[model samples]
Target: MDWIVPLILTVITASTPLLLSATGELITEKSGVLNLGVEGMMLIGAITGFAVTVSTGSAIIGIIAAAIAGMAIALIFAFLTLTLMANQVATGLALTIFGVGFSALVGSGFVGFAIEPLPSLHIPFISDIPVIGPILFGQDFLVYLSIFMVIASGWFLTKTRAGLILKAVGDSHESAHAIGYNVIGIRYMATLFGGAMSGLAGAYLSLVYTPMWAENMTAGRGWIALALVVFATWRPGRLLAGAYMFGCISVLQLHAQSAGINVPSQFMSMLPYLATVIVLVIISSDQTKIRLNAPACIGKAFRPAQ
Candidate 1:
């Protein structure tokens, strides 16, 4: 009874990072670009946001810095993947490496620094409800924003001309080019948005969850977010489900430890990841379903004619 509310909130909060990054990456992937630099983008964002917020005492500036930092890292990916036609896997790997090392170096001085988190706004009656009230309704604005972002992303992709064009570009670069859609441009923009979301997700880690930074603190959230895209079958609504599902597993493992369940913490820590692999195997095991779900040109390069 005591832990139920905190557990629920923790699960939802934990899922926010994956939710934002996956939603953005879904759009990027739907545009036919696979970005592996989400980890790096997120790290940079975490550091930048933390530093900015600590200095200015303004969460808004911190979030903005996070977004900018993510976009900046993403631009490097765009240059390699879209402009130079570099391999997405190689570029993504490099991004992860860069994020890990860079975050360690930049955050070395900020290991224990602390700052006040953004204030939470609660609805009158909802905020007063027993355990659920404070945990759910009293959350910071970013939590609500995460929900809004999901909705906005869904509507934009399924109900707009730009969405259709992005789909065409992802499905077939040649067809997009034939009709005058700028494949590179679309990919670059889409990837930038993905990076921004990834950054915001990272900021949440330092600014909200832990209120501190350590080397590679993102700890493979970027990878989880990537897998979520496939699990969601490139659909926003499904991605929300997957994000929360994964988040719940992750939170429960920790809760099990807190409850003294006698399991090793390391093993519990591994549960979420292990679950990810099992779920992916199950989802992709059926050939027909996999074919029906994958992006048509997920890793394909687009070269527009002169």
Candidate 2:
């Protein structure tokens, strides 16, 4: 019973960044743009956030700077894909490669540096109450924000006219353009939003998850988040569930190693990624579900009728 609370807390911490990144990607995909540069964007954000926090000594400011950095990189991707009509898949792969090198270069000077972790919320009596209280109210602002973003995103997608317009563009950009909606403009906005969220996720990694700067610290979680968007079939509620489920798998590996479960350390470390492949295989088997939920124009470059 005592271990349960701590385990759940660890799971929440593990899930936060994935939820943030995936939710943003979900919105990006929903707009019919497949930006596979999420991993790169997250690395950029992680380095920028850590650098800014180290220099400014403020986690909040570091987070803002990270978001801006992510948007800046995402803008590059958008310009190449949307304006120059470059190949989306090629551009995205290049973006990730660029991000990996660029972040390592920029973070070189900051290696081995550590900073104070983000402060958690404490709501007087409520936060102190046994399991339920701490689990619900004792998390950091980013944790709460992640959950709120998912809920808000769900509502926005299902209930708002803007959401409908976004969906319409994703389903049929030509039809959306014919209806007078600015298809490219809507996609640009969605891509930027996704970048911002990825940046925030990176900040959470540096400021809260590990509270330090290291080269390539995201550790492929960016890819996991991408898989999560697909795993959820682009639905926010399922996205939340999937993120936490992966989070649990991640934590389980650590616990297994600690408990001397006799598995090879390398194999234990591979659990999260292994689970990702299995889940993707299972999800991909359901072609009908994916076709029904995935955006119709995803990965297709939309050229507005001149």
TM-score leader: 2
lDDT of 2 by residue, 1-306 (tens): 788999999999999999999999999999998988989999999999999999999989999999999899889998998888788889988888999999999999999998988889999999999998999989999999999999999999999999999999999999999999999899999989999999999888988888887888899999999999999999999999999999999999878966779998799899999999999999999999999999999999888868
**Distance from true location, Cα of 288 in model 1, Å:** 2.0
RMSD (CA, Å), candidate 2 to true, equals 0.8
lDDT of 2: 0.92
**Any idea how many clashes model 2 has?**
0
Separate clash counts for every candidate: 0, 0
Any runs in candidate 1 off by more than 4 Å, and if so which? none
lDDT tens readout by residue for model 1, 1-306? 877787888887898888888888999999988987787888888898898898888988999899888888999999999999999989988988888888889898888888897788779998989987897689888788888898888898889999888888888889888988888999999999998998999898888877778788888888889889889888899999999999999888878866779988899999888988998888778878767756689888877778
- Kindly provide the TM-score of model 1 when superposed on the true structure, using C-alpha atoms: 0.96
After superposition, candidate 2 runs with Cα above 4 Å error: none
Identify the candidate with maximal lDDT. Answer: 2
Clashing pairs in 2: none
